[model samples]
Target: MSIAASSDAARATRRPVNANGVPIHTTSFIGTNWTNRTAESPPPPEPGSYYPMAFLVEQPPGSVVQSHFHAADQFQVVVAGGGHLGRHAVRPVTVHYTNAHTAYGPITAGEAGLHYFTLRNGYDPGARYVPQEAAALKAVPGRTPWQTTTAPVEPGPVIEGPARMEEMLEPRADGLGAWRHILPPHAALTGPDPAQGMGQFWVVTGGRLDGMPPLSLIFVNPQDAARTAMAGAEGAECLILQYPRRAADA
Candidate 1:
């Protein structure tokens, strides 16, 4: 569903908590906890930020996720702890992009456990287990020649204050890309225009980004009318996502 553009949208913040302000229930990701905000369709239709669905997964120590792929594209960030994304070490704030049907993982979390935020631009296509196939195709988990792009797997330098935008991925249509917004109190941002068939999403990583204040994960579908400008409630920082336009409609 496309999030209609809003010339006047109110920012609403939904923490990863429940109606009582406690964190919400989570689904199991292998042996981990998956806290999803937009795993389903749009609702709580007040303060949509960027994409339609997103989740936070906490992987336990020694956790191993089998090699798998999804029918849809994904953008995952390592928020805390340390782990191996395939063989690449993933630490806090490492932003990773994966194309449709791209294979990844065998993620082994560090002692402190690995925590990451996962976002999806399109529908949840679920997971396809393919440990054997994934292993056969991999020379390197994230840098496979055919499945990889030149995008940085790690996050770029943090830009603070003044409300700056960093185009982590070149603008394209379809799928997903990476972006970050660093804002001081009362600052605002408009996501870069997406290529046709492409959409954007905004998620607050540090402080609060909202149409109103403390907006957490808000979806911004292609033409969402609910809200336009994202403002920092305080010393806020955010990660923006763009679904890269693809060919063959793939």
Candidate 2:
């Protein structure tokens, strides 16, 4: 098969994407009061593969996100403000990757409060506070405190790179992996690096992603890496998902 044909065939294997980023106005789910703007929704054509979705999460000044857990794994990019991940001091652009049922938070917002973009991959049964007995907890017992296979929580920033690209964190069995990509204004991905052939969802965190908006993200099959285009005047940075794209049975 020709390279382009082969690439198109590969891209066709993944889920369908309804272009145009969705807005996530406001939500007060969990125990804390916060807001969000969604960029992607559940994959429409798949049943068990990683169905990644991206959204913005915000907490007001002086507020706190009580300790909690979720049914699916997640990545949080502190896109603005500063805060505490339990005890660690976290500022804008600090990244946090947490596995299912991995307890974390009691996150108190800093003077400027907190704002983040949460990219979730897998089944989202919703958020549940720590302590299985909490009434605010939403996950069922079986999936509530789901079998944790990675550390409860991870926090930090993407490593600086001369190429403006870097693998921020590697995933464990239960953890999700993340990579940061920085592009100068009007520049774009030359092509998907062969090393990044599994699959990825680019979450636009800084500046603007021409075809998409800030807080938006798009998934690309490794084989069809050339299908992506990044263009904007102020340059851009994105948090890319590094999780496997196969079905649970595969």
Candidate 3:
């Protein structure tokens, strides 16, 4: 499926805020069948804080995602057919939660990919997700690379290479940071080394995997980094959600 763009007509059609003080805005990207019960916004972090959580979701078949990692803790869950997780030996571990900070990839060899979602604890401007600096935490050796071109835009160092890991940081705000990952067939992605941040939470959104039932969800605590990975079989795709922590004053 093509990535949906925010349209001027859709923006013009935004409804006015109701009596509940919610800002009116057009919603897209989120699945059409899903309901929008709340407003979405970007977070504004103070100067230094640390909140970390994440969600992993599964998407429809035939999706593709480039290899990448973030500077926060991460997590994932299998929502569809079995896939591979990193370069390790392929196993039939379906619908299980894995921690952030370790490398993982799809396990299956077919065309079907696993869909999952993750949420990390990070900064947010009001209800909007944002990124901020942590306390005096030193960057993980060779792991804190940053990037600015991706969605949920932030101003951190850009990460490079296929063998890099994510860095952990403290949150400067209070709220949840959200992101989505689309993994394609026959692809491989690794996680940031755990010693960098906190942990993560994940959820599955679509597709079907071997060991995991449809729509299954799980959490990847900080200690389980070595066990996370996904692999797609024939004609499968996965959507993973990630939430990072935020500070109380953000």
Candidate 4:
């Protein structure tokens, strides 16, 4: 399908409520034809299934994200910055920039703390941030807490190049399928893309993504399951969160 046709399809399938019950909005790009996903939602979990959510976080110098854990596995892609992990005396470590799938954080350490992002797998139900007791973990002064990172899994060999789109079979064992896409400037993908199966959420990272004409975010319900489009101008890279098909339909 042409980029326009694909965007129209995406809009037709856009889900209204994110996992957290937040209302989602889809807008078009100003100069070019494109769509962007915006908003935040709580993580959803179902027995045997997994859900994927993406965020574009910005931490000021020395800021810190208190340690936290989750029932399901979590992954993070560091787009920028250098930081340390662990409690007490933070361990010096550099985040992975090239590889998006690399897992970090949720490590177990003695008395000393384990510094890292990305929730650990098989911990508890729902997304879990650090508890109040451990809130002391702070990003060292002069450095911002880990921020401006992309968690989209690297695209597969079949789909390569500037449009670095990756499809990963979320290892939830619950029959849940989740994937992330990182599109470069002027790059776009058509549906029925995976984002359609699970309602999608997007965050802009860098460069403006023009959402106009055929390029847009679409939502389609089962009744018609087609014919809807929402476009927006994404000034740079954006993040996307997609809920499971069952949850989205719910």
Give the alpha carbon lDDT tens digit for every residue of 1-250 in model 3: 1111222222332333221122222222222211123445334343113443322233324433323233443433333344454443212223222222222332333356444333334321122111222221223343433221111212122222222222222222321222333334333434333323344333323232222333333434344552244524421123333333323222
Q: Give the range of the ten consecutive residues with the poorest summed lDDT in model 4.
A: 27-36
Better of 1 and 4 by TM-score: 1
Candidate 4 residues 1-250, lDDT tens each?
2112233333443333222222223222111111123344233344223333222222333544444533333333333333443422222222211111122243223233222222122222333345542333242223223222233332122222455433433423222333344554356544234434433323233343445332222222223332322223332233332323333244
Summarize candidate 2's per-residue lDDT along 42-153 as a digit string, tens digits: 2342322344455455566766777777655566767678878777777766777665556777677778877775655454534566665355444344342322112222
lDDT of each: 0.54, 0.52, 0.31, 0.31
Q: Which model, 1 or 3, shows the larger lDDT?
A: 1
Tell me each candidate's TM-score: 0.65, 0.61, 0.31, 0.33
**Where in model 1 is the C-alpha error above 4 Å?**
1-51, 132-161, 172-176, 195-197, 211-215, 225-227, 248-250
For residue 233, give model 4's deviation from the true position in Å: 13
- Score residue 142 of candidate 2 by CA lDDT: 38
Candidate 1 lDDT, 134-203, residue by residue in tens: 6644543343222332333343333443666666665544445576667766666666554443556565
RMSD of 3: 16.6
Query: Global lDDT for candidate 4?
Result: 0.31
Order the candidate numbers by TM-score, best to worst.
1, 2, 4, 3
RMSD of 2: 10.1
Give residue 12's lDDT in candidate 3 (0 to 100): 33
Clashes of 3: 130
